[model samples]
Target chain A: NAGVIQTPRHKVTGKGQEATLWCEPISGHSAVFWYRQTIVQGLEFLTYFRNQAPIDDSGMPKERFSAQMPNQSHSTLKIQSTQPQDSAVYLCASSLDSGTEVFFGKGTRLTVV
Target chain B: AQSVTQPDARVTVSEGASLQLRCKYSYSATPYLFWYVQYPRQGLQLLLKYYSGDPVVQGVNSFEAEFSKSNSSFHLQKASVHWSDSAVYFCALLNTGNYKYVFGAGTRLKVIA
Candidate 1:
């Protein structure tokens, strides 16, 4: 079975532009997670959704970062006014439910210039 | 605060040799432990996980991990290494009930022939 699916494996954006990343979780999975990976930060949790409902988003940036799971099938992470510091690989993962093993997508690498 | 630590930033081993990668976690109660591997230009994949029952868990590609509650550690091991085994290994802790998965900085493994 195909694991998680993320669109636009790589994206490039100009400074102050907006960038959106997409993630489609595996079928029947109940938990979707967004993480950012960088050479310096490694992996940082951004948000999570359970049963199409946002369960936690404490890791999201207070200002320009937002994530949404409008339905059970997919989720989106948007970064507005993207800066060079925002450049990183945005990883999307899904799990069967809480406390289960998670499967990750290839990730979308964002380059803000 | 909950955290996962992978002390070794990089570990190099000769081909056909045994391998071990260390991981430690900090949390209040029992937590789900996991090991994920990311190959070059690829997404993360589960190497193994420990939730309960057997302290030693086997995963794909002849990889295994042992959970030690006393030491607060979950370390990944392989009987013999192959060149294909070179990758970044991340240790993670799934917080009990909170649906938060914290990942370590990751250890980059290099198998030299």
Candidate 2:
């Protein structure tokens, strides 16, 4: 099924630049989730979408982070003015529904220098 | 606040030995619990989950987890481990009102031959 596909397995960006991570969910899946993982914070939920509609983004940073699911197949997470603190593994996951077992993609590692 | 705790940062076990990884969660109500494993350079995969009906849930690769509401614990176990089982294991919780899954810091398991 190709599972979930995340683009650009590794990304390096200059501080203050913008970074965009992509995720294509599994076929027939309806729920997509974004998370950030680091040595200090572990895994933190950033946002989630259901059926191409934003569900909850309470975990997203209030200012520089935003996410969008333009269609059922894919989603994007954008970080504006990326900083050193934004350097982490950005993971994308999807599920049949909110309560279903989620499948994850091999996250994109973001390095802000 | 909803959270998950995996006290062990890393664990080493001899191949063929029984394995047990601990997980504890904090939530006011019944929470959906899950165990996920991540191989090196790969995304997390569901090992097992427990919602209701069964205290012990069987998952792929002979993995199983027992959910205890009284103790607020959902621990993963395996009767016998193999070298291929080495990976980082994570415990997650999903609240009734939220779609984002709260995750623990993760326990890295190393099975030595």
Candidate 3:
């Protein structure tokens, strides 16, 4: 299995620009999750989807961050008007279902310059 | 309201020595506990998880964790350390009802020769 696949291993965006990260979940998995990793905040859960529907997004920044899972196979996280503070590694994970072990992808490193 | 905490920000141990990393959680009920390791420039990988049953759970690469309900802790341990084991370890708690994983600040482990 290729596990979860995230595109653009690294991305550099200027301040006020937009950045979009992509993720392809494992086959037959029902849950997809997004997280942001930073030295200061550590791993922060941004959002999650189960059965192609959003469940919780309390961890996401209300203004610039948004996530969508249009289908069972893939999901996207978009950051609009990105700022320097938005620079961090974005990780995507998938699990068979709730309470199951989740597998993570290599992650996309976003650098807002 | 729910959260996980890893007290030690960094830890160093001699090669072949025993190691232990601490983790604590804040939640009303027993949540699904997990230990994950993140190598540099990579995403978090599941090392082990504890749902119910036995308090001690084994993981890949000779890693193990013991869950303590009374203490609200799930600490990871290894009998011997190798240089390759140098990575950041995160403790997470999942509320099966919500399906979101709350992660700790993480502990950076370093094995010295």
Candidate 4:
């Protein structure tokens, strides 16, 4: 299996610039998740999608962060006006169902300067 | 508020030595716990998981994790380590029936040959 695929393994952007991260989950997986990995904050859940529906996005920053899964195959996390504090590895994961063993993709390392 | 903590930020062991990575979770109800490994420049891969029935679950690469409800701990152990085993190990959790998973800061294991 190809597993999960994420585009632009590494990204660099200036402060105030908009950034978009993309994730293509494994085939047949119904659940997709987004997480931010950082040294201080650790790994934090940003949002999740199940069966192409937004289940819980409480982890997302209400103002700047947004995620969408128009189709089951792919999901996108968009951050408007990226900040230096937003620099982190944007990880995407997938599972057959909720609360199951999720597989992760090679995260998009976002570096905001 | 459910969460997972991996106290050790890093661990080092010689090849062929026994290894153990500790994980503790705080959850109101019994939740699903998992261990995942991420190699350098790679995505996270499932090592094993525990839902309910058994206290111990075996995962790929001869990795095993024991769930202790009384202590609220799920520690991952292996009888012997290999040079290839060097990677960052993460402990994750999910609510009783929720698919939203939360992950630990991660424990980086360095196996020396």
The C-alpha TM-scores of every prediction are: 0.98, 0.96, 0.97, 0.95
Every candidate's DockQ is 0.90, 0.88, 0.87, 0.83
User: Where's the lowest-lDDT run of ten residues in candidate 3 chain A?
Assistant: A37-46
Pairs in clash, predicted candidate 3: none
How much is A100 displaced in model 1, in angstroms? 0.4
RMSD of 1: 0.9
lDDT of 3 at A14: 95
Runs in model 2 deviating more than 4 A are none
Give the CAPRI class of candidate 4. Answer: high
Q: What lDDT, from 0 to 1, does candidate 1 have?
A: 0.94
lDDT of each: 0.94, 0.94, 0.94, 0.91
lDDT of 3 by residue, B27-99 (tens): 8887899999999988889999999999999999999999998998899999999999999999999977687
**Model 3 lDDT per residue over A73-105, tens place:** 899999999999999999999999877989999
Worst 10 residues of 3 chain B by lDDT: B94-103
Any runs in candidate 1 off by more than 4 Å, and if so which? Answer: none
Pitting candidate 2 against candidate 3, the one with the higher DockQ is 2
**Stretches of model 4 off by over 4 angstroms after superposition:** none
